[model samples]
Target: MQRKSWKKPALIVAVLVAVAMVTSFCRSRETAPAHGNGAPAAVPIRVAAAHRGDLDLTLKVIGRAEAYSTVNVQARVSGQLQELLFKPGGHVKQGDTIIRIDPSLLQAQLDQALGNLAKDEAQLVNAQAVLKRYSLLIGKGYVSQSDYDTYKANEGLYLASVKADKAAVELARTELSYAQIQAPFDGIAGAPLVYPGAQVTANDTSIVVLNQIHPIHITFSIPETGLAGTQASMARGTVPVTATLPGTKLPPMQAELDFINNAVDITTSTIQLKARYDNHDDHLTPGQFVEVVLPTTRLTNVVTVPVVALQNSPLGSFVFVVNADDTVQQRMVSAGPSSNGQIVIEKGLSGDERVVTDGQLLLVDGARVRIVTGNG
Candidate 1:
């Protein structure tokens, strides 16, 4: 009985050991990192190739559309604002009669001046005839010399009066013409400050503002850093510019660089530029905000990459370039001006390498990669 008991205990111990070993083996298998063919796991990522192409660098800035010219249409003569021949915000042509003042008062003054001139001319003619008679009588001794001299002096006085009267008539005519106000150019007339029957003073009252919308001038500013490039492009020819309104389907309006400020603004560190566009359809209005795109410079046959591929770190800007062996290596690049969606790689790229654009979080330097989409 003792031998049988000892053998039974030994068997139990053996079975327990076997069971513990199996449990430990299973736990080890569960805890180990799984891999196929004992290879490291690959990171899933998308990539775009660093391409070689001519990059036309451009700069986009906010601009304001302004009238080519603006003028304040004021009353030239002081009188009652009798008629406003233009509608508020209406278009007017050059020399179009825009305002008609009450001409009755002006006309009366003109008539009075004209009557005075006629009377003076008639008196002048009579004085000349009397002077001629006096001359003939003096020669014949029928009139005293003093009487002749007096008549001659009177004739000169009448002649001076006639000359003065003629000048008055011209002045009256000019004053009469001022009763009608004309437009100086083809433009949009703003609100009339003075209504009809309201007395307005010449050159003092704010009557209406006229703005020439066609051939609109667009004013924009750029950082002083871009001044050299802009001037270089201008030296070759007029630098081209285009304006567009956001949230609209209209095509970009073409313009040319027409003016550049002589000095940079000290406070803002920017330079102002003006572009002109022939807005024949009158689409662009003064004071309307717009987006202006201007070509700043051009890079020839340079290595470029999507902006997304370029990454920033504490050190500087860099990108992940995929090697021939399907591995990625972080490449330090000298980045230049960015245009559209691409940035010029001024250094560290040979213009044909594939750069990792996505799945960057799953990547490290010298990590193996599978080109999922044949990034090129």
Candidate 2:
């Protein structure tokens, strides 16, 4: 009985102490600040002023450089290759001789055709003179009508032979001219397939490959969604394009939009486009991969800001606009297309406001901000 009584008294004391502790905690909670310190510390951030400027709608795509023109030089006439006029990888101009076949045989054939032509011409002249005299005698009874007709027929035969011989001469001359293979255009020539002393067949032998590189073409594709915009830009006049080499620090190559395929590629859902670059500096090479930036639209005189300034929440896309008092006001924005590190703001925030580009995570409406960059 004594032990049980002592237990009850100790238990009562413990209950009272617990109630006092609970009361003290409630009081401390009531007295404490609701959010952080009573004096809110200023949030550090970087900002950029919204300004009226121009921004281009562009997309970067991988493009492949190609020769403006490529041709496989072939022999038109059969002969033993006498000389390779150009070294492997040599540059040749239009009509420059790149290969030479043994011309002695062709020369002899031309001479033979010339001789046949001369013989036919002489015979035609003699027959024509005899036919003229016979015609005069036929009228005066010095020659019979049948005899005159025979002379006239002989003259026609010689004339026909001369015409045939002339055609033969032209053909022979054409064949002889083919002995020296000429470059079709200004280009770089590949290694000759047929060396000197090698027999080459007409139209069956490839002498070299020529690739025109001065004005290079870059072929690439863009998403079909951009096709309409690209077409619109093209309709406004020449659309500008820029090509950059992947691993070089050189400035980008400026080019013009040259061709857009009539139809979209069903397999890839992309529209093929080609850009022409005057690669006069030899900066671009055929078969090289490059990054091509094509501007689809040009938005001018619009309020724009850095893309990072735009933020999103459950509500919508918004930005923290800093006031002259260095306080932030959350404003919902209708964000348009973004490009070149900037985005166009179609609504909210005029061109005179400053926006927080960084440290936006700690920002809220009516929150104090410290402008660490841009206008203080």
Candidate 3:
């Protein structure tokens, strides 16, 4: 009986030990690391090949639209406003009649001046006849020399009077012409500041404002560093410019760079530039703000990469280039002017390497990579 009981207890202990061993073994298998063949997983990335191409260095800036010419039409003669030739906010051509002042008083003054001139001329003619007679009498001793001399002096004074009266008539005519105001250029006229029948004084009353919309001017500024390139390009030919209005569906306005400021602005550290556009459609208006795209220079046969591939570090900018072994190597790079979503690789690139564009944050020097796209 004692042998049988010991055998039963040994069997129970054996079963418990076996059960524990099986559970531990299963747990070990569940916790074991798996990385697609027991190696660290390669990071999947998108890349682009650095290639030689022409890159245009375009500078975009905020610019303001301005009228090519602006003028404040002012009254040039004192008179009552009789009629306005143009309606408020109307278009006018150069030399178009814009305003008409009351001409009744001006005409009367002109007539009186003309009468005075005619009267002086008649007296001058009479004086000449008398002077001729006096000369003949003085030579023949028919009249005293002092009397003949008086007649000659009187004749000269009458001639002087005739010239003065003629000048007065011309002055009256000029004054009359001022009563009619004409537009100085082709432009859009603003609201009349003075109404009809109101007495307006010369140079003291604001009549209307004229703004030339066609071939408008746009003014913007650029950094001083770009000044040399802009001037160089301008010297070759017309530097092209493009301007767009924010939040508008209108097409960009084409312009030509025309004016460069002689001096740089000290406070802003930027040089001002002006471009002219043929705004025949009247799309651009005076005092409107716009976006200006200025092309500073064009580079040829330059190595370029997407700007996203560049990584910054304590040392400097860098990029990860893929090698034949499907591994990435970190290369220090010198970056130059960036435009149109690409950055110019100034150094440390040979224009034939595949640079990682996406998934860069997951990479390290000499890291293994699986190119998901752009692999040849």
Candidate 4:
């Protein structure tokens, strides 16, 4: 009876020990990391997203600025520069005297011409009297017809001399007027090439340069492919253009299209164009290169995302889309032109979807993602 009772107690202890071992094994299996499963925990990355909306397509190109009118002032007559009527680099109006040449020689010539004209006038008066007398003598037949003819011929010779002298007088007057140089238009003058007492010749090197700045012209070139679109836009109405000065943060100046080249450049395949701006403040200068911005028609109902969200691989461009279940989906997308650091998503994305922008390289398809809202 003692042996049987000991065996039953030992068996009960063994059964309790087996139950404790099984319980420990099940806890360990449940607590260990799961592996080789289809779904895995995802690494979190910062991201940004936005809904699609209407956007504008803009074309950008570098352009240069030019003056509306440029003039190189030159002398019209050969003479010594007697006086400077305008200060160098000063503004002048049309018909304003810019330089004066000595008129003494011209004046002397004019005086001589006048004296000769006076002598001719006296001779012409005497000729008229003689002709009148010959006419009277011929009517009375007081002398031979040949004698009267000789008097008439003498009168005609003196009259012709008077006309020649008159022409000389007019010639002298023109030379006198040429002594003064005048501005042809309203503009700012450049430095004078010839100072007072310097000799100047007609059609010689330019004495100064004058530029009209009130209405300035901006010239730029665009690829020939842009011509059709530019023409269409211009046909519809005036196209707006903005020009920004170099190395300055100031706002761009406004301008309008003035001209478009009819022919395209075969070498560069570019179309030259010009814009006019009201530069009454003289802010823009000639020959200065400027940045040009031309706004095109806006696109409607388009999808655009930050440029950083895009990834390139052998499979092409893609984006990581976050789902409602806190899972990521890798989707192939088509991209359009980028502007302002934002790229247009042409396909594979809807307005209601969220895309990863800041960080996306660590994403994998169907991976559980931790939602860290308001952390960006």
| Candidate number of the best lDDT | 3
Predicted structure 4: lDDT: 0.81
The sequence of per-residue lDDT tens digits that candidate 3 reaches over residues 86-172 is: 977778999989999999999999999999999989988998999898888788889998998888898899999999998999999
TM-score per prediction, in order, is 0.70, 0.82, 0.74, 0.66
Clashing pairs in 2: none
Show where candidate 2 strays beyond 4 Å.
1-46, 52-54, 298-302, 313-316, 358-376
| Residue-level lDDT for 14 in candidate 1 | 100
Displacement of the residue 353 alpha carbon in candidate 3, Å: 7.3
Tens digit per residue, CA lDDT, model 4, 287-368: 8888887755556788998888888879999888888877788889999877667788899898677877655656678766
Per-residue lDDT over 319-373 for candidate 1, one digit per residue giving the tens place of the 0 to 100 score: 9998898889998888987898999999999988889988888888988887776
- Please state the error at residue 246 of candidate 2 in Å: 1.0
lDDT of 1 at 103: 87
- Candidate of highest TM-score: 2
Tens digit per residue, CA lDDT, model 2, 263-357: 99999999999999989898887899999999987798899989999999898999999988878999999999889899999999678999999
